[model samples]
Each structure stands twice: as C-alpha cells, then as structure tokens.
Target: MIVVGIIGRPDSPWCHDATACLVVDGRVVVALEQERLSRRRFAPGEGPEETLRLLLAEQGLRPSDVDAIGYAWADATPEIARRVDSALPCGVLGTDRLTETVFPTLAAELRNKEIFFFDHHLCHAAQTYWFNPHRDADVLVADGTGGAGSTSLFRVRDGRFELLDRYSPLWSIGIFYEAAAFYAGLGWDAAGKLMGLSSYGRPSGRRFMTFDDGAGEFRLDPALRGLPSGGFTEERLAHEWTAIFEASAFPYAAGASNTFDYATFATDVQETVEDVGMALARRLRRRSGHDALLVAGGVALNAHLNRRLALESGYRRVSSTTAPHDGGAAIGAGLLAASVLGEPVRRRDPADPLPIFLGPAVGTAAIEAALDAESVPRQALEPEKLRAQVAEALDRGEIVAWFDGPIEVGPRALGARSLLSSPRSRTTLDRLNVIKGRAAWRPAALALTGAGFDAIDIEPAVAGLTEYMLCVHRVGERDWDRVATGVHVDGTTRAQHVADGSEFGALLGAVGRVSGLPGLINTSLNLRGRPMVLTPAHAVELFAEAPEVDLLVMPPYLVRRP
Candidate 1:
C-alpha cells in the first residue's frame, strides 16, 4: 500500500510546521517539510499541497497510485473544529468549511481517496514508536495542545498501542515552557534558545512547576496555559502571564538590560521541565513495566532533559526519532495509515541506527550545473584529494560549506548540509554565530567518528542518543581545552556520531590526521531565519551570500570565492 501523510490546514493560524511524507509497503520513501520548499520558518498559515505534490512527483507515482491519505489532525470532531475556528482571526471561515468544504475538495482532487484523521498526540506517538527499534516499550508524547490534550502516555506491545494516561491541555508542560520563554523576552518558538541560555545561570531553590508521581498530576497555573483566546492574538496570554509572574514576585524581563536577571528564571524553568519529565517517565515505567522508553512531541527535543531521562529515568533504554516535533507528525500519520490498511509495520533492527537522511539527494550533474551557472572558479578533485584539501582548509581556521547526499529530514543539519570548521578556537564559534545571525552565546555541535567518544566522558547506555545530536554529554576535564569551542557554558557538548564508512567520516579522519582531533564544529547551512539549503543551487546561493565561508565542497567539485 502507498500512503501519503499530511500535517497542516490551509491558512489556519493555529496550524504550523506543515509537512508531508510517503510510505510504500510500510517503509518511508520520502519526507519533506513545507518550510524547506517555501523558504519560510515553520511555514505558518500554509498547507501541505506543495509538499504532497513534490513527494508524489519525486517517487514517479501518480495520484491514482496512492492507496489512502492521512491527516495529522482530527478535524471531524466539533470540539476541535470549534477550537480551530475560535483561534482564527476576523473574516476567516468557520469549522463547517473544513469538513464541508476543504476535506471534500481535497478528496475530490485526489480521485475520492479515503482520508484518515488521527489524533494529534497519537500521530506523534505513532511516528516515534514505529520508527524506533523497540517493539514493546512505554511511549510519551508532550507538546502544545493536541486533539485530546497536551501530554499522553502509551504502552506498545508487539505493534499494538494501549493508552495508559493523558493530561488535559491546561496541565501542559510544553505551554509552561513556552510561557517561560516569552517571559524571558524570547518568543514562543525560542524554546531551544531558552534551553541554551539556561546553562549560563544557576537554578534557584524555588520550583515554578511540579509533578505528583502517585497522582500522575502535572501542576502549573491554569492562567499561564497560553492557549488561543477568542482570536489568534497573544495579547491575552501576555497579560495573563505578566500578571501571574508579577504576583509571584517574578517581574517580567521585558526591558531588562542585563540578561543575567532572566538567566536564573530560565534555569528554573529548565530544571522544572527535567524534574517533571523524569517523574512522568518513571511513572510510565512503573505502570507499563517496560524496560525501554520512546519519547516524542515538541518537549522531546530538549537535549538536556533527554540526557537526564536516559541516565536517571530507570528505563534501561531511551530513544527518540530525529523529527519529534510537528514536522515529524507527517511521518507518523503515514505509518499509522499503512497500519490501518493492513500493511505490516517494518521493524528496525536493534543493532543499526534509525535512517534519518530521508530527503532528496542531489546528483553530480545537478551540482556541476549549479557550479557552471554561478560561473565561479572551481577545481575538480578526486575523493581522497578533496578530503585532504578540505581538512587542510578547516585546520587553517576556514569554514567550509559541505553539501552531499540526501538532506536531513529533522531540525538538525547532520553532515548532509552543514557548515563545518575546526573546533580548536573560541573565535571560530563566535564567527560562525555571526555568519548564521545567531547570538554569540549559542554553542555549536561537534560531529565526529566513534573514536571521538574516547576523548569525552559518555555513558555507554546513552551513546545511541548522541548519534543524531539528540542529547548532550559532559566534556572531560582533560579534553576541555581540545574541544573548547564546541563545549557550551556548562561544559557539555551536543555531539553527532558519524559512521566510519560515510564520506563525512573520511573527512573527519583526514582532519584527525592534520590536527589530531577527529571532530569539527557542525551547524546547519542556511541564511539567517531561513530553512536549510535544499538544492544544489540553494547551496551555491548560500556560498555566494556568506562571505565568511571559505570553501564550498560538493563532492568531486570544490569551489572557492573569487
């Protein structure tokens, strides 16, 4: 069966992170986010039409070839539809337009193919659990509001999912963190930034949020839920959060000149999240009696919390998919559709890592065409020679834009489309943040081979989490000077473990030969506030725009700025 999964509603303010994926015979063929093609961050107020069409065309399959379609939202219910309508701004269509107009129009366009609507949190759970290697494990899904609630727990035994516990949106930990982000002068989407900033301050003794393990309750103020009011405006939430924080003796940091004042607040929020997450995982473990845990949803993206869960949650094993956020819901939707259609879900081998480079791969002809179109000075070198030259350039403190193979599907850059530089100096980190239009305090990730782990203090049980840079590890005191640039303010580094046989691994080996270090700082290759480069032309365009990037490497052809 060929199933197509989509996540988004056309022109819906509450809907974002539009994405689409294709699954053929229970295997993921391609997954793409609309933001990447639309060149808009999160692709707010957009639909998945373009992304769905691209996936069909890329696979050489026509509309008739698709067996069914899956939507990430359960729009058929009156409650969800009413919620969506209330969140829309003035002059927008009501919920009737969705079931009476939009979905029907979609079905007609696709030759009357059956469309399946799934619960939002179920999509997250299905997506993460289906792709994971664990067959019987406890699953946790936590995000902003979903159809039923914000947080959900499930137990999977031999491909069957049993709902264990769920929490209402009012008790959402995701919204609590989002409110903390807003109070710290960062936007709602700046949860990653808040996580990074938390490292700079020590946690206060007070806890803003707590969880009861026995009662399975997530405690927080309901006024700080930050849900959409009558319209798609944040003013109401802003006022409510401001009043609540002020009442608690924690004034808003709207105009604070020193960010340090909010640092403690950020740290407290981070700790609260960790504490609650651990509580949830432990409770789930006891309820389900499972040794392995699979985590999904937006909150699963927190590396520190993930690291702590892996170490202290008592789940012998913890794993998460590369795209655990809403963008990944598309993949989950596809998998769920395939399961409903009587297709057996393919189980991943326990020994191998999950395949993340699932996007389209650019060919040599396309790379050469892009280079010729730019008319830049270039040199064609053999694979070995290219690696050596790129290593030497990086050792000389120069940045290289590495574009090869398929693009990564998740938020991380990985090695497919990344800007790489030697992690030998703090100056390199500062320069990279400037080029990427990020704050100077943000830290970069280190990409290295299996041997690189010997230089750091990492637990063997949690090593799998480092493969996709999903968790952070403490930098050994002795090797602190070696990877100072990649280490964050808290002395932890988010490391990406590269396979020994991949092209990126060979390049790291060459760098190790040249500089005695097997790792380099790796970050996404994109213009500021834009999605990562998708095509060879996009890579070339970024090379032309970012003057600080010294070399552009697209295997077999290396281009240098004139």
Candidate 2:
C-alpha cells in the first residue's frame, strides 16, 4: 500500500514545521522535513511543497496515485489555544475555525485519496512504541505539549495500542525544565545546552521539590506557592523560577556561565529535573501497572532522568524512539495508518528498525552537481575507499560533512546527515561551535563501531542506542581525555551507536581501522537555525552560506570552498 503520513504544528517554534513520511511497498520512505523546503527550522508558516514532491517522486506516481494521506495534529488545538488564551477551562472541545483552517496541507493532497487524522499523543506514542523496534513495550509519551496531553501511557500487544491513561503537561517536566533553562539565561528552547552544562554542577539539592499526592501532581513548591496547575503557565513559572534561584545562593542568570558557581547551580537544576523525573516514574508505574515502559516526549530528552527512571521503576527495559518529540509523529502516524491497512510491523530490533534513513539521499550525479555548482574541487572514489580517506582526514584533525545516504529521522544526526570532525580536537570543537553558531560547550556525539566498545568504557550500546545521538551518556574515564571534543563538561558524550551491517557501520569501521580510536565526533550537517539539507541544491546553498565548513565529502564527490 502506498501510504503517506504528515504531522504539523501550527504554533511551532520554527516555521514550515511539517514533516512528511511515507511507507511504500514495505519501505519507509520520505524523511523530508518541511523546514528543508523553506530553509527554516520547524517551518510552520509554510506548507509542504518539497515534502509533496519527494513523496510523489519516491513512488514514481503523482499525488493521485497515493492510497491514503494520514495526519497527526494536537487535539483541540485551536480551541485549546483560545481556551488557554481567554482563561477558559474546558473538557470536551467545541468548534474551532482557526484549527480547521490549519486542517493541514494534506487536505490539498487528500482530494483524491482517503484523509485520516491520528491523535497527537497517539501519534507520539505510536512513533516510539508502536513503530519502534520494540513492540509490546511499555509506552510513555512526553513533549512540550500535545494539545490535549502532555504525557500519556499505553500498552501495545498483538498489533494494537491499548490506551492506559494520560496526564496534563502542567506537572510538565518538559515545561519545567524549559522554564528553568530560560530563566537560567540559556537561550529559549535550548534545554539541551543546559543539559550539557549540568555535568559541571555539583547537585547541591538545596532546591527541593514536593509531589502533591492529594492532587496527583508536582511543583517546585515554595517557588510555586501561588500558582494553580492551569497547564504549563510559563508566565507563572517565569516568576517562580526567578524567585527560587534568587532566593537561593545562585543569582538569576548565574547558571548561564561556565563557572564553579554556575556548575553548582546547574546541579540544583539537575536535581530538580531528576526529582521530577523520579516522581513521574512513580506516577507512570501506578498508572500503567505494566512492567515495560516506553517513553517519548521532549522531557524524555533528559538522559540522566531517563536513566534514573529506568533504574528506579519496576520496568526492566525503557525504550524510546530517537525522536520522542513531535517530529516522530510522521513515523507514528504512518504506522497507525499502515497497521490499520494490515501492514506488518517490524520488530527486528534497533540495529535494523524500518531502515529509518527514510529521508532524501543524493545520488552521485546530485553530489557531482553540487561540487560543480560550488566550483569546489571534486572527485569520485568508491564509497569504501572514500570512507577510508574520510577516516584518514578525521584522524589528521579535519572537519568534513559526511553527506551520505538518506537523511535521518528526528533530531539525531545519524551518520547520513552529519558534520564529522576528530573527537580529540578541542580546536575543532570550539570552531565547530562558532561554525554552527551555537555553543562549543554543547558536546558533539562520537559515532563508534561495535568493536570500539572494548577500547573505551562505552556505555552499553543497548542502554543507549542514540545512533541518532539523542540521549547523553557518560564518557568513560579511559576515553574522555581522548575524545575531548565530543565530551561535555561532565565528561559525558552522546554516542550514536552503529552496527557493522548499517551504512554508517562502514564509516565507523573505516575510522576504527585508521584512527585506532574507533570513533568520530559528529554533529548535524546544517548550521544553526537551519534544517538538515535535503538535496544537492540544498547542500550547495548551505555550503556557500555556511561559515565553519572546510570541506564537504558527499560520496563520489568533494566540495571545498576556494
């Protein structure tokens, strides 16, 4: 069945914030994000133009040839916004002209095919639990907000998602940290930056939180003295967070700097995050009563907390898809539709789940075209040989864009769409930060081969399979001093685990053979505020505009600015 799934956000932080994914003939295709088309990260202001094109081309069929178009949207989206806007509380939603207008661009494609809508939270959970490599796993969905839900619990057995329950995001761990991060002066929506900074902190635990059992909720308590859970009121939190830290020894923005005091302050924040995470763990267990736990959502982005939850909860295994955020909804919505259509779900394990490199990939001609357009030096080497050459460059302390196969799903830079550099190069780290217009202190991920595990104290690749580089794991004492560029201040690294059979496995093996270290630090292929590039033309535009790039190794082609 030729099925297409698209998920969008109306008030997304970024524009053209739409992602289109397709499942065609047992192949998971169309990894294109709307941001690629508009050159905007999370493009919400635009429609899915390139997305529509890629889907059409992948099937060699026009829009009319598609079987169905599935959509995932926040429940009560327009009404929620209005209700939240006018201080009105609601249960069942009423008419919403604003949202129906947003009815999504899929309506444009659905004229000839069946149009279906998947619940927002359901879509998120489906992405991680239903479509993830682990079926029948305990499921948890957490994100900034899912319109109707901030978090949800579910059970999947025999190709079905049994709804367990949901909780409002107010006790919203995502919003709590987001507010703390913002108040900490770490740019807005840049909680990852704070996470990287957390290792430097000492976890003083002065800022204790309380769980309101009577109300079945949590709050920063003293800081949250006057507020009621009206559902993630950042305004209320802005004042509360400011008061708490100011009341504490740390100044309001003291956590922003990389100092002993700031690190200590980060410890407080980490403690707060952990406490909240643990509390959620307790609540989740009570709600589901299932041994397995599946967690997806922005809050799940807190690796330390996820580790804590895993250790504390009765659940033996905690599985989360790489993109727990709304981004994965495209994949989830696809699964929902596919399953309904009687498509077989794959549980072959993470090493080979759906071949998630479902986005756009450039052919030799596309790469060569980019090289010629940029007037950069060019050549074609066999991919295996090119891998060796690239590994050699990384060993020699070079930074190159490994613009390989199909783009990755979600936010992790899974090999295909990565900027490669020597893990040990401090200079490269600093330069890379400046290059990406982000923070150097924010660590890059070390993409390592399976064999490399013994050389260093790599975390159990199974405990953390961030082959997409989403979760953060501590760097082993043996490897920390070596992979300096990849290690956060806390001596932790976000490692994207790759296996030998995978396409990225070749690059890892090649790097291991040449560097003897078995890993290369990798970050996203795009610069700050930009989406990962999708086409050779997209790459050319970025290479011309990108300031930190030194070379682009798009297989069978090379591009280096003059």
User: Which predicted model would earn the best TM-score?
Assistant: 1
lDDT of 1: 0.78
Report the lDDT tens digits of candidate 1 across residue range 1-562.
Answer: 8998878867566678988899999988899888888898998977777777777888888867888776787743334333322111111111322432333334445676666667777788888877878878888898877766778888888877778888876666777777777777776688888899889987766666678888998666454434334432233444455455645624454535665678888898899889989999988988998998888998988899999999899888898878988988888878887777778877677665457888866789999889889787789999999999999999999999999888888898888899999988888777788789988887778887877776566433264467778898878677778888888899888878887787788999899889987799999999789999888999999998889898999988899877
Clashes of each: 0, 17
RMSD of each: 5.0, 4.9
Worst 10 residues of 1 by lDDT: 85-94
lDDT against the true structure, each candidate: 0.78, 0.66
Candidate 2 lDDT tens digits, 43-128: 75554545766767765777656676556663524433322111111221222233224335544544545444567777777677
What count of clashes does model 2 give?
17
Q: Which segments of candidate 1 are over 4 A away from where they belong?
A: 76-109, 221-239, 249-251, 351-353, 457-463
